[model samples]
Target chain A: MKFSVILDALPYLLEAAVTTIWVSLLGVLLGQVIGVVVCVARQSGGRAADMAGGVYVSFFRGVPLLIQLLLIYYMLPLIGIDVPPLVASIAALGLASGAYVSEIYRGALNAVPHGQSEAALALGFPGRSIWTRILLPQAFRISVPALVNELILLLKASSLISVVGVAELTRTSQTISASNYRPLEIYLAAGVIYLAINGALALFGTLVERRLQQA
Target chain B: MLDLSLLVQYGPSLLRGFGITILCWGAGCLIGMVLGFVLMLLRQLPVKPLRWVIRVYIEVIRGTPFLIQLFLLYSGGPSIGLRLEATTAGILGLGIYGSAYFAEIFRAGYQAVPKGQVEAALSLGMSYGSILKRVIVPAMLVSTIPAIVNMMAILTKETVVLSIITVPELMYEMQTMAAETFATFETILGMALFYWLLVEVVSRLGRRLEARVTRYLTHASPQGSSSETATARA
Candidate 1:
């Protein structure tokens, strides 16, 4: 294996890795927003909202993210809602991540003892404040590890967005491989970049978890 | 706005595609289960270096995207003169990729088996394989249902990635049909439904299996307060 090929490709691959990060970060943020809303709705005591949230989770979790991306990228154009490749990619990822995030939030929220809520209710605390003060904080603490897992999974999944021709790390590596005919080297370099990114995320997650435990 | 006629036109091919998808997933699941069990057992060995090697293998496989792994296995194979058919590569890639996760699940399940039980079996002069076969395996199977089911769902969704390697699975067939007929939305939606139903079936099977196992255990030990049955009942 020629080392120079990897070095020459490293800069370009890193640039695309930035795109991968950007896309995944946006997806994670958007997914969190969707998750928080869906989680709240599912527990909010409204039948329609709860049912809608259930359907959302089931459908998203059931379907593959690749098909989601393809549908968003292709179908939206026909409906006159033309989304750029990157936008479609982010939207697909965000939507799919939302389902998993909602489940994580649900598990975390359930972990917060029911007695705490009942105690707050007996104390005549308002519902919103009970949630804000007693429930969400505890749920957030419980959710940090799973939230980090979701983030790492999303980062890895961003590779699939390349199917829509968004030139992320995988796509960039594929491009270089095509040009240089060095699939082994280019692919290995891309894998290293992915491992490095995910490794850092895992470390950060552990640090945050430690701090949370300390608090 | 999907054309119903297009569905009628492509139903046979699409059904064939679905069959291929199930074939690949089933084959991959078998390989994953066997390999994952081996990895889990290897993890139990007292050798520190061997355990570390297995740990690294699991981490690396779990850390990267399956798409990259597929490419490396399928496309990179020719570079090493180990060229495999697309279907073979797909099955192998999914199995190898899935073994890391399955190994973790199996390890967790194995750990959930009470240590005392294994010790008791040893004191009774039961051989290692016999103890594992009679005690550890059954207990772990019951404990690992949820994790195993979750992994099955994941592996099923991941089969779509095989399309990248030109495996003639559901997604690959749908992509080909879409390119040929330009019925993008219809074909994509149809494929989505196919996958949705496939996942639903797997989850239903998981629930049934869980119920069956729980029922069998409940019948065997009516007074047992084991948390496994407690959670299973709940």
Candidate 2:
């Protein structure tokens, strides 16, 4: 209820929000890379590749991201990989987001009419160009909305990375609230910050979607 | 590099934790569906303020992370004179968080019911109760099963956030076991396997339920296009 508590905590929380954005952006970018690969594997018409892609999607999508984070954060040290908390957090998030992103790409690709691919094939276009030049552009356009949704979800899920000791917004809020004994105001401020970030992302997504539609 | 013996030492406690996880998930989902149904119904009312409030509620819940919500409820409760135990706060937070999504699903389900069919029913002198029962319920159920199932899977995963509040769910158990024995790989993998199985079962059950509902709806209607269209929309 104290306005001063929230006002004082705002600077720290805002600083940490930058970290949240950075982590989520990096995670989403990594996820898109992994997603494209898995999507290609799934669509390649090779049995082993398809199965590998399927298994990757199923395992990542099935398991909770928290456990995945803990697995990476803790298991790597045991194996002498020695990844930092931030790296492990991003890796876990990227690996998990890849599953969802691949599905989004798959849906977008399927939404692109099959006839377009066939027509390109009949025109003597190679399969590689058929995908890269013709299909991928359209599919990427179709995937923008879903990709934005995934990005927002990843931003929210990034709060869990606090478990691995990253001092993101949520963790920083926890720290300040514990010190100041104003959990209500601190958490409420954190939630509003999250809402603002996600709201802006949603608005940006709508603009991109509109631009794509016009194009 | 993987250890199996750690499972023997920690398996019983993990199983207990799994039971709590399932309990919280089941109870939370039930509360969510019921509350969500109420919210959906409230949205249908003509009161502008009520509808606006419900809209804001849905947006706020959907916009933020469940971990923050749980923190607010569990840590911030006493400030608002609403003290809650960790388990109670966890379940309540999950329910409130999930209700927003379920309400949207219910609204979508209602919208999916053809407006023309409702008009036709009204023109045929069908009462509101009978029309809802005979026409809307069946159609909505058929259309909403997959979404409902998907929400259930999501809720199951959200239960892991409950561990942050120290609810002693599967993740909490895994964390404790890992801390105690430094068997992070084994315990984390064990936790993942349990969650994977749970999610697989939920999705498989959802598929079965979808098939059954479609069959039932198709069998009830001679034209059968209703179920087909519903499946297509889904």
Candidate 3:
């Protein structure tokens, strides 16, 4: 349990933690967009759109994110649409997160009562405005907790991108541990950093949830 | 633009890898459930330190990624005078990681059981063991089936992380095949299909189990069958 090695590693690990955060934030944001699209497709009342959304959700959710990363990283080059490791990693994370996010949004949407939408309809609100102005706001409030959970999950999962050669926190830890021969302390330090980041995310989620409740 | 011939060439090895994945997942789930159950039981005891330790364990495991956990177990083992093979470390990591979640699920399920039912059992002179076996366990199972199933699906996916440790599971096999044949697309698609099937099977089995348990509970106990059905439907 040498403290010096961890102290030396802290700066590098923190830098890499930023990469982890940046990648995961992008992934989560992209996932939210994809989730909204899929949610709309699922609720669009057309069979093809519904089936397309269903398959997208099932395939992405069913397959592991690690495999998704590998698929994107490797398959893109063969198709002449080459992407860097970071791009592939983010894309994979976003695609996989989109599936889970869509499910969360669906649950939140369902929690919003049907009567609200019907009332808006009877009040002569257009369908688009009714959804965007009325229903989505309530559903967004309902989704905050789950969305936070997904973000934390994605942040933790960003470690998998190390497989594609991204110099993220986990990879930096691995590199340092290999060089320093202090796997236990280094990995534990990495774990602490992860815990700190995730704890803050959880706290933020709690605050948001409280705010939503008050509203 | 897609090719199917690669599957014919790599089918046997991929099948073997799939088997290994299933084996690891099964062993890991068994370990997780048993350990989680024990942890849940321990948490119920009136020991402050024990409860505190269990809470920390759950929070730490839930907060971090399983990849870091696996790295700690596999790479960090030698420092602690514990050296484990990749496969052993992978399975052990999955179990330890999953136990935290399962324990929480068990606790929640136990709490979901109505308080009056436990009180009635207590008043009827039923022993703690009997009440646990006849009343609490059944209701807990009915309530926790979905969560348990969800965790199992998660564990199934986590098996892929084992490949990072060179455990030769499905992902490892796919990567190896892709590197060798340059058939990355085919191998990746095959891997995806295999996992999709596995997850589908797990969810289907969970639904069936839930149905059977709900039916058994409905017939065995008439007092709260309606609410049980409502929960089951939900």
Best by lDDT: 2
Give lDDT tens digits, candidate 1, residues A117-179: 999999999999997899888988999999999999999999998888999999998888999
When superposed on Cα atoms, how far off is each prediction in RMSD? 2.2, 2.1, 2.1
User: Which pairs clash in the backbone of model 3?
Assistant: none
Candidate 1 wrong stretches, greater than 4 Å:
A118-126, B221-234
In model 2, which runs have C-alpha deviations exceeding 4 angstroms? B1-9, B120-134, B222-234
- lDDT value for candidate 3? 0.89
Which lDDT tens digits does candidate 1 get at residues B1-234? 567787788778878877888899999998998999999999999999999999999999988999998888887678878789999999999899989988998887887777898999999999999999999998888777767887888899999989988998889988888998888888788778878888999989988987788678678656452576344322
lDDT of 3 by residue, B188-220 (tens): 877788888889999899889877877787787
* Cα lDDT, model 1, residue B92: 94
True contacts kept of 2: 0.79
Kindly report the TM-score of the first chain in candidate 3. Answer: 0.97
Model 3, which residues run further than 4 Å from truth? B1-12, B225-234
